[model samples]
Target: MLSASEASIEAELKTKGLNAPRLTPADIDAAIVGEDFHVFPGTTMTVCALKLRNGFVVIGESAAASPENFDASIGRRIARDNARNRIWELEGYRLRSLLAANA
Candidate 1:
C-alpha cells in the first residue's frame, strides 16, 4: 500500500513537471545525515534521506501502519519524521552514530 502511494506520488510529481532521478542507495546514504526509527503497537516509522534530481535532497518517512486506529501512529510518525529532519539538518553526525549503532 505504501509503495503504491509512493508510486502514485512519484507519478503525480512527474505530471507536475518533476522528473524522477535514478539514485542509487549509496547516493542516498551519502546525502543523508541521519535517520530515526520508531515502532508502536502495530506500526513502524522510518525517516531517511532521499536524493532527488539536480542534487536535491529531502527527508522521507516510510511507515507501515495498521489498518485500524491509524491516526495516532500516523500522526506520531509524521511528528517524529519532521523532528528528525530538523535535527539532521542541525546536528549532522548525532543521528549517524545512532544509525550505525543500530546497524
Candidate 2:
C-alpha cells in the first residue's frame, strides 16, 4: 500500500475533480447503509466509499436482498462489486480471475 497521508489523498482526489466530502467514522457508517440518500419507494441497497486519513479507501455497501429487485438491487451489487473488483484489478489480477470470483 502506498500509505500516503489523508491530505495527499484529498489533494489527489481534488486534482481529479472528485469532491470527497469530509466525514467522521459515524457519518461514514451512516452513509454506507443509505442514510445519505433519499428514500426511494423501490430502493434496494445503497453503496458508497470513504477516504481515510491513512490514504486507504474504505468501501461501504448494503448486502444482498432475499427476493431481489433487479434494477436497484443490481445497481447496488454492481457498485459494491465494482469497487472491490477494481482493487484486485489494480493489484494485477487477471480479468478472468476477477470474473470467476464474481461468479
Candidate 3:
C-alpha cells in the first residue's frame, strides 16, 4: 500500500504525462505463473519475469535477504515495483514512437 504522500506524488507524476504503472496487492496476487512466466530465486536476489500475452517480457529483481528487514513481503514488493518500472519504460518508449509516427 502506498502512503498518502506517495500516492499524491504518483498522481502528480501521472498528471505531468509521466508513464507510471501502479500495481495493487490484488494485481500482484493474481499474477499468472507458469512455464512462460515465473520467479527465479538466486542466492542474493529474487528475479521475477512476466511474459505478457502480447509477447512482452517484463523483468524485476530484489534482494533475497536483508539483515535489517527479514520480511519476505518487502522483497516481494520490491520485485513487483521493479517489474512495473520496466513495463512503464517500455510503454513510454512505444507511445513516443507511436506519436512520432503519427506526427
Best by lDDT, which number?
A: 3
Choose the strongest candidate by TM-score.
Answer: 3
lDDT of 2 by residue, 1-103 (tens): 2224545765677789875334322332333322122123555556645443345564546534653554664555556544544444333434455666878
Poorly placed runs, candidate 3 (over 4 Å) = 1-44, 64-68
TM-score of candidate 1 to 2 decimals? 0.24
Overall local distance difference test of candidate 2: 0.46
After superposition on all C-alphas, the RMSD of every candidate to the true structure, in Å, is 12.5, 15.3, 6.0
Candidate 1 ranges beyond 4 A from true positions? 1-70, 93-103
Sort the candidates on TM-score, descending order.
Answer: 3, 2, 1
lDDT of 1 by residue, 1-103 (tens): 1346556765777689765334322343355554444444555554545343344545556554554544545655675455445434543455556667878
TM-scores, all models, native as reference: 0.24, 0.27, 0.58
In candidate 2, which residue pairs clash?
A: none
Report the C-alpha displacement of residue 95, candidate 3, in angstroms.
Answer: 0.3
Model 3 per-residue lDDT tens digits across residues 1-103: 4557667876787689876344433343344342122344434465667665456667787874554654466666677667766665666676678778978
Off by over 4 Å in 2: 1-47, 50-54, 58-70, 93-103
Local error of candidate 2 at 36, Å? 9.2
